[model samples]
Target: MAALDMLEREPDLAFSLNGLARALKVTPMALYTYFGSRDDLLQALTERLLSGFVTVVDGDMPAIRRVEAWCFAARRFFLGYPQLLGLLTWEGGNTSVAWFDRSVVLIEALQELGFKDAELSRAIIWIWTSVMGAISEEIRNRTAPHSLSPAQVESLDPRLHKPVRDMLMLAEQPDHFDSFFAYHVERLLDALRAIAKRP
Candidate 1:
């Protein structure tokens, strides 16, 4: 948790165990005492943030509602943490199984809602990818300067270009992020619902 706090203050914490330890005024190896390895620490950091943000679902609640509540909390959490977004992208550089269990929790919640094996797998990947992608897009579009220039954004002008430009512009507006994220969330839930429907 301290490392996460330090990460917000120091972007280098995403990659540096030494930086995090130094911020906590401890030796680098001391961090491994709490976490088995640097990768473990990163997983723990991610888990800690999500746990703080996502409340546990009540089993008696409608499964669809449970999934919706879980994802909305997840999107809200990721949106608030810029440093976590960087670390999420950094995670692709390594193979860590530690975070998979957290993902399983999401998948299993859907399973209780009656999603079968293949659909559960698809749903898990779909939910994670869409939520992370949307938030990452919003963050990059907002904080980082746009890679596309105004001229570039305007250059595409056939039938579809206006819609593309409008979507790109919508991604940058802070006020619309919730609706943007919610639209995708609802769409994902719809897919899950179809997958769970009785034949």
Candidate 2:
């Protein structure tokens, strides 16, 4: 918990046994009593962060709606702990099995809707990527707030790219991000629903 507190306080700080020990006001050797290595400590923290992330939706709900609920829930959960995103990205190949295990409910849900091996894998990847991509955009918007100026949008030729200009204008307002993310999620689920219906 102390490690997580340190991480939340300084999200960019790299994990190290020495650093964590210092933060906790204990000797580095004291950490070794609880963790075998820095990786072990980090993995424990990661598990704590993700332990309660379940994607199970009510069976009474439409299968596609279940999937949509999972996607949105994942986005909201990860957005709450943006630091976990960076840790996961940095760990990459070294990530723990717990990370992949979080998808079991999602995989089962897709299976119920007729997805099989390869298709199921692809669907899982698409759902996760879309959620993560949206979260990344949201984090950027919240932290950096980069948006095109009206003058910049107007500088583009309207005749050639009116829609592009309009999109640029819309991007200027971070308030619309949730609606934009929802629109894409719905479109993606529509495509998945069509595929599920196919024989």
TM-score of each: 0.73, 0.80
The lowest-lDDT stretch of 10 consecutive residues in candidate 1 is: 89-98
lDDT of 1 by residue, 1-199 (tens): 6765775665433446677777789987888887777777777665665554654677687777777776776666665665565555344486334346445557667888786777767777778778778777867756674546667766766675777778768766767767877888888878777877767
Residue 139, model 1: Cα distance from true site in angstroms = 2.2
> How many clashes does each candidate structure show, in the order listed?
0, 0
Q: What value does the lDDT take at residue 125 in candidate 1?
A: 75
Worst 10 residues of 2 by lDDT: 84-93
Query: What C-alpha root-mean-square deviation, in Å, does candidate 1 show against the real structure?
Result: 3.7
All candidates: CA RMSD in angstroms?
Answer: 3.7, 3.0
In model 1, pairs of residues that clash are none
Model 2 clash pairs are none
Residue 134, candidate 1: C-alpha displacement in angstroms: 1.8
Give the CA lDDT, 0 to 100, for residue 198 in model 1.
62
